[model samples]
Structures are given as structure tokens and as C-alpha cells.
Target: MADYLDFVGDPGRDDVEGWLYPTDAHLMSVVNDLQVDRGFRGDVLEIGAYKGKSAILLGFFPEAGESLTVCDIFDSGAPVSDGNARENTAFYPGLLQTDFEKNYLRFHDRLPRVHVGPSEELGEIVAPGSCRLVHIDGGHTYEVARADMETARRALGPAGIVVVDDWSSAHIPGVAMALWERYLTGELIPLAFTKGKFYATWDPAGLTAGEVADAVATRPGIEASGTVRLGRYAAAGVTMTPGDWQRYNAGLRAVYSKLYADGGASAPQRVGF
Candidate 1:
């Protein structure tokens, strides 16, 4: 059996390459509470998986009979529309499902069920109310983010959590606007915000934002501000301490450095599908 520590330690560092912005420790703790501590049950879903970084973390908590579904465009060429999504996808040297699979398999024995296409098609592929957690990290464009959020709403089961990446980042203002619009209209309630992600929920009887903030406050090395209630829900901003940040970066660098020494390059290229 794969241990939680394995996914939280060197394997995680090697798989993510520091691309997961919320800090691995913070994400791990939240998922741990949701899965192990609270026993939230259902499959996991990620709309945007970049090299299986955060997707790998989502893979760790699925129990028997539950699968993790990852949706990404991969090598299918960028979206047709000319916007931030196209620009961002083009910026990457390459986007390949093979590289994501290789990184993911380094920790787990298998890959999640992959949907290699636009995230807008997610609702058609995945069953409604089947996911325990839905992560939206795909396209940064307003249209894409809005579509992903709607998909998340339809995909989540009772007690399920939805996390959107780059929600408050200045570079991705579209994501922030989309999320805020939903909140203002009472489509979703804010739970918490990390450096690069926003956590929300649609289940009123499920975990509350204040509860999430309280749990974060108890974790070591994380600094969470006092919760601020907004309408029916509450939210708090969280950040990792400087020492924890340094340690996390050091582990990531060590793994990549070793890979470089063995393979003549730090980063792995796409393997043939």
C-alpha cells in the first residue's frame, strides 16, 4: 500500500516540481482531514492537471471503488480561442500526457482516469454528484473558468469540496472574477484561500469555511488569519512560514538535481503514448 507520507514527502516533491502553488503541506493537511479524519467519501476530479502535480495529491486519498479523474488538453493542441488560455498553453515548452503519467507513476502504481481534452467537456464525461473534491486549475480565461466552475458544481456530491487554482493571482484575474461572481450570486460559498487556490463548497450541511479555517490554524508551520464571515460562509487567508517554504523548496531541488545527474537533464520529456 502507498503510504500518505510517501505522497507528502520526496515523491510529492519530485512529482510536483514546485508547480502546486498552495504549498504541498497545506493541501495535504486539508485532504487528510477531508478523507481520513472526516471520512468524506467519493471519487476525486481535477479539471486542470499540469504534469500531475496537484493531481497526484488528489490520487492519494481515493479508497477502493473510487477513482481519480484528471482532465487536461495535454498534446491535443491549444484551444481555438485567442485569449489568456491560448497564450499560457503556448508559453509552456511542451504539454504532454506522457510526462504527466511518468511523474504520477513515480509515486503511485497507476495513473488516474485521464480525459485528454478541453475541461468544458468534463460534465459530459463525469457523472453528476460523484466527486468528493473537484479541482479547477485548467484555463485562466473567464469563459474556461466559468465553464469549469459550473462543471464542478454539477460534479460534486454532498460534502464535496471544490478548489480553484490561481483564484486571486494578479496574472489570472479572470479566475478571480469568475469565482467572485459565483459567490456574489450565492452559487458557491467561500471556504478559504491559499497563496494560489480558493476552496469553496455547495453543500450547506457539509464542512463550512469557518471549520476549514479552524482546522488550518491547528496545523504547524501554517499561519492562518482570523476568519471573516461573508454572508452565509466564512473565509481566511493562509500562508506557510519562511522556514517551511525553504525546506519544501530544498526537497524539490534535491530531487530534480538527482534526476538531472542521472538523466543529463533535470526535467523529464514526454514518453510516447
Candidate 2:
């Protein structure tokens, strides 16, 4: 197995080459435990992959028979809503499939099945009920978010998870609205929340969010009880501020990089909890 720690300590850093948020570590733990530890079997899906940051991590958990499907606009010039266009222009001006493939190849030998167009084309591409984990981060508008959630639900298998990005961000209230509306209507059961993602599932038996948070709390410097109850479900929060976590992660990345550069073995090394 590839050393996950070597590739994922800080994906936004120069060496890692992507735009992953720091809370991704917690998300990784959730995905790892569900697919790797619990032996869930199915393909992986992600609606938005800017440069394969989170996609790289998701790629690591797919079992032998599973595939990872990544859907992104990727210089397709597809027409989007005005708001989405503005946001994409401002944030992902240089988004390209080649860059995504290059970065993904650093950690994975084969590139995921790439769908280059609007996420609306997902139904025609990915089979229904075939995904173990589906990540929705494509568009922040209410229409797009809701449509993506619907697609994710249709694509998820039993015990499958749907992780939505920017769910609670003040700048992206549409995502929160879409997710809460689904949760209220019983289409989704809230599992957990990271700094930038909301994890949900259709099955009540998949209540592993609290366990994920508890495991993260056990990390060296993180405070306990990062898990919070949300009505019938659970949500996890980061104890440290985003800035603090970035700084700490940068330090850890530097240490690991140096250790690996010295021809040292890549064993799992625990840092702050």
C-alpha cells in the first residue's frame, strides 16, 4: 500500500499540489474506516475535483473490484448559472484536467474515470446504486446542489455515504439549504460535519460519524467531544481553528518529507491528537 501519510499531510502545500482543506484528515479517517476497516464494497464517486486533492484520498480506499469516478467541468466550457460562473472564474480559473491527472498520478498509478462536463450528465455516465461514497462539491447554487444530492442518492448503494462540501459555509448557504431540506424530508440522515464537508447517508445503520469524530479527538492535540448531536444524527467539528491546523500540518509535513527524503521507512507516525 502507498504511504497515505506521505501524500496527504497537507495537500495544499507545494509538495502535495492541490487545494484540500485541513479538515480533510478527519474526512479521510471517516472514509478509511468505512471502506477499509468495515469492508464496505462499491465504487467511489466525486462530482467536483479541482485538482484531485480529495480525489487522491478517495482513490486510496477503493478495493480491488471498485472504481473511482470523477466528474468535473475541466475546461469543458459548459454553460453554468451566473453565480456559479462567477465563483468558478474567481476560484478555479486555472482548473484543467491535465493538472488534475498529473497530481493524481503522483499517488495513484491509474487515473480515475473522468467525466468532463456538467454534473447533470452524471446519470448517463455512472450507474445507479453503484457508489459506496459520493462527494458533492461541484456547484454552490441551490439548484445544482439539490440536483447533485439527488444524483448522489441515486448512485449510492446500501450503507453508502454522500459528502457535500461547503455545506455550512456562510458564503455558500445554498449547500446548507439543499442538505437540510433533504435531511428534513428523510432523504438523508446526517452523519457528520467537517470544516468544509457534510457527511450523510440513507441508512440509519451507518451512524459512524460520532466514531470518526471520537477517533480524531484521540489525535495528539485535538480536544475531545468534537462530535455534536444534530437531532437524530451526529456532526463532527474541528477543535482547532483552520489557521492553527494548517500551521501544525505544515510542520508535520516538513518533518515527514525530511524523514522520507533520508531514505527512511514510511510507517504510520502519530502526531498531535
lDDT of each: 0.73, 0.74
Query: Any residue pairs clashing in model 2, and if so which?
Result: 219-273, 220-272, 220-273, 221-272, 221-273, 222-273
Q: lDDT score, residue 114, model 1?
A: 94
- The worst-scoring run of ten residues by lDDT in candidate 1 lies at 264-273
Q: Which number leads on lDDT?
A: 2
Off by over 4 Å in 2: 10-18, 214-224, 238-273
Query: Mind giving the per-residue lDDT tens digits that candidate 2 earns over 1-273?
Result: 235543444433335444454455445554556556666778899999888777888887787898999999988898888988998988778778898899889878999899999999999989998988898889988989999999999999878898888887798799999989998985577766656677778966654666666666665433333567777766766554555566767777776777688688663323432
Tell me the RMSD of model 2 versus the true structure.
6.9
Question: Taking the tens digit of each residue's C-alpha lDDT, what string does model 1 give over 177-204?
Answer: 8888889988687777776777888888
Structural similarity to truth (TM-score) of each candidate = 0.82, 0.81
Model 1 misplaced stretches (Cα beyond 4 Å):
1-15, 21-25, 246-273
